[model samples]
Target: MLFYTVMKPLVQVALRVFFRQLEVRNPKRLQVPGPLLIVGNHPNTLMDPLVVAVNRRDPIAFLAKSTFFQNPILKAIMESGNSIPIYRRQDVETGAEKLTPEQLAAQNEAIFGRCYDYFDRRGTIMIFPEGTSVQERRLRPLKTGAARIALGAEARRNFQMGLQILPLGINYFDPQRFRSDAFLNPGPTIRVADYADLYRQDPEAAADALTEEIRQRLEVRLVITRDAAEDELSQQVERTFGSHLNPDDDPTTLYDNFQLSRTVQQGILYFEQHAPARLAEVREQLSAYLSELRQLGLTDEALESGRQRPGTRLSRAAKATLRLVLGFPVYLYGAINNYLPYKLPSMVARRATKDAEFVAPIMLVTGMLTFSLAYVLQTMLVHHFTQDWRWTTLYALSLAPTGFYALSYWNNLETRVHRLRALRLFRREPARTAGLLRQRGHILQLLGEARAAYLAARTAQRA
Candidate 1:
């Protein structure tokens, strides 16, 4: 609560000074006068909760991973923010064989019970269905935890409690960067009646229904700048499900557990009919939507595409010259803009994909410059005030970028690498050279194939 007292004002002051404008929506709706369960899509690390806190005065509690609670300082900060701890019982790597059906059911019931109690008491709880942050464009397949909470709460109270679950979409222009653009968009609240009975009979399905509804709402509100084409959709599906496929083993049956239905197929077809005029916008919207779904942990197969071979020496020379001519400025601006946070007003920073690993060299360079400037200032202060250079030299050297790099080497490096890998998928330009028309045609073909596959699988599964 104290952190909120100091943090909100500081955030406002900082956002005002750094950004051209700060926009917020649904601030009033956040103060729903009941036991509120604020559910959201996770996008940024550490920043998601802050955005929600900045919008309200209430002492909201959030469920954070148990690992963060291990650190005394971090635990204090989280506790101060009124965050609850969620402990995962099973070791993720032990695989399904390690758990019996009975054990899994017991664990689910225990978690459900805890969340239900919290919601019943009118305690505000924040949960990220995706469980982890991806690039905010699409949501991953959500864990059933949120659904369990909502359903369990409904069941325990016989769907009569004044409990409301608010669907929040956290949209970040550039996550993992300071002073970036973000919007805390809220959707209509879900009532107990929406899924109480369904949950009582089949909690898993009820949760999926709730998540799908949230996904639909999120697709409309969270504005993603780039759009995906038909081909890009294939690529997205590939990226999502690529790891699931095994080169050594081919399965006889294809599953349709996570797929769009025939009605959605018709809707997508209708949208594509006007794709020429609205393709860019629609593609972006769909891409953003699918990206969110991906974050929710759904696995889709990767799209298959062929790589074009380089031409003769003359053609190669021409290509090299073209790349050199165009790539230099983009690269130069990207390198220089590394000094600024990706969230800054500078177009250069904004254009660069938010890859934390790529930002390291930039941070290191900027840190060196900052340290040098500080050292010079401190040296002058010491010479004028005390005639002693020892303290100045010690402080300056200790705070240098090299020292900071050494300190952050083991941990920050891994985090940067992980983020870089995640962002790498976004950097690819699947439609860059195929010519817009050709790419669109390819995408349409792929979309048809995906739909056929999904329908066939669904029909077979039902049989």
Candidate 2:
């Protein structure tokens, strides 16, 4: 408990720095807690637990794969963080498989006993029902461990304990990207006590039924598609049309984006069932429109207001030029002061690992350490050379704000460059630009029609 209290603030700060926006929907639902079991989908590996852990007031002990405990440093950290290790058949190392079936059964029994004890003490335990992390738009078949653990604990106490299972959906905009967005949506709580009667009759049957119910509830909150190809199309549609439907510039809250994605998925399904030819034509048009945007280095927002008038284009150019002129001095200062710390993490990650899921966490941890160390070294060198503590202190303090300004300046610079290129294309390649605009118009029309049809069908079904 002491360790959790001490580390909670630090973890929250790290997560805030790592993700640009982390919004937790219906956080109040998590307050009615006792011996709570949190079940969430795993898309990001270690990052998933970190997200869930920091959101609530209660300290959560997670169930982690046993292989993570093999490393001494990591095991120390995990133990300190109140994590429980669950051994899996796949985690048995070759030539190091020491535990036989009986021994493994004993280990699991001990683990479950510990879980029951923890519940008796009114602690929260979080488990990823999917058992493994995969970066995809669909949920995998849920394992029965979560349901089993909850039921076993309740049954052990004669169904008197108030144990509840909370289902959470972790939606990541780009899980492996630094400064990306994530949304934590909490579903309705399942009362373990309510299932006691069923468990009393048939344990296995009760576990299966509870698992399926949890799966159904979780599926509603996630953007699950049929396959990879459909998932890709749904994502593309969301990226293209999301801004129009959700005009909020803040990326911190992703509920709106998730709704837009769900709507797109529904539209895709409706088209496949009712209007295949129309769907095929629209898909081709969307593909071409996306290709043109890529070729011209443009975004959907650039054309959100439709084809720009000549005066509006000229006004935008003049405003952009003025911003460049005014901000150049600060940009230069920031770039000079914060170049190495900003670049080193990316370089290290590129050379370190090929796994996409591991890259973001690695970069975040490495970047935090690198920046802190570099600032300290730079401050000491300044003091050594000038023999002035005031200047060194000022330099150290200026590091963070300057780095933030540099990031903002770089993003603006990229946007300005893309806009400039787009303006040039608009002026010089009138024919091509016109054709692209026509394709955009067609795509929007199709989307509007499909959205209407989809909503109508959904309404009829509900009615």
User: Candidate 1 residues 203-238, lDDT tens each?
Assistant: 788888887876676655554323344435434433
What lDDT would candidate 2 get against the real structure?
A: 0.83
Q: Where does candidate 2 clash, by residue pair?
A: none
Against the unseen true structure, what C-alpha lDDT does each candidate score?
Answer: 0.54, 0.83
Residue 203 CA error for candidate 2 (Å)? 0.4
Query: What tens digits encode model 2's per-residue C-alpha lDDT throughout 390-414?
Result: 8888888887777777778788888
TM per prediction: 0.49, 0.94
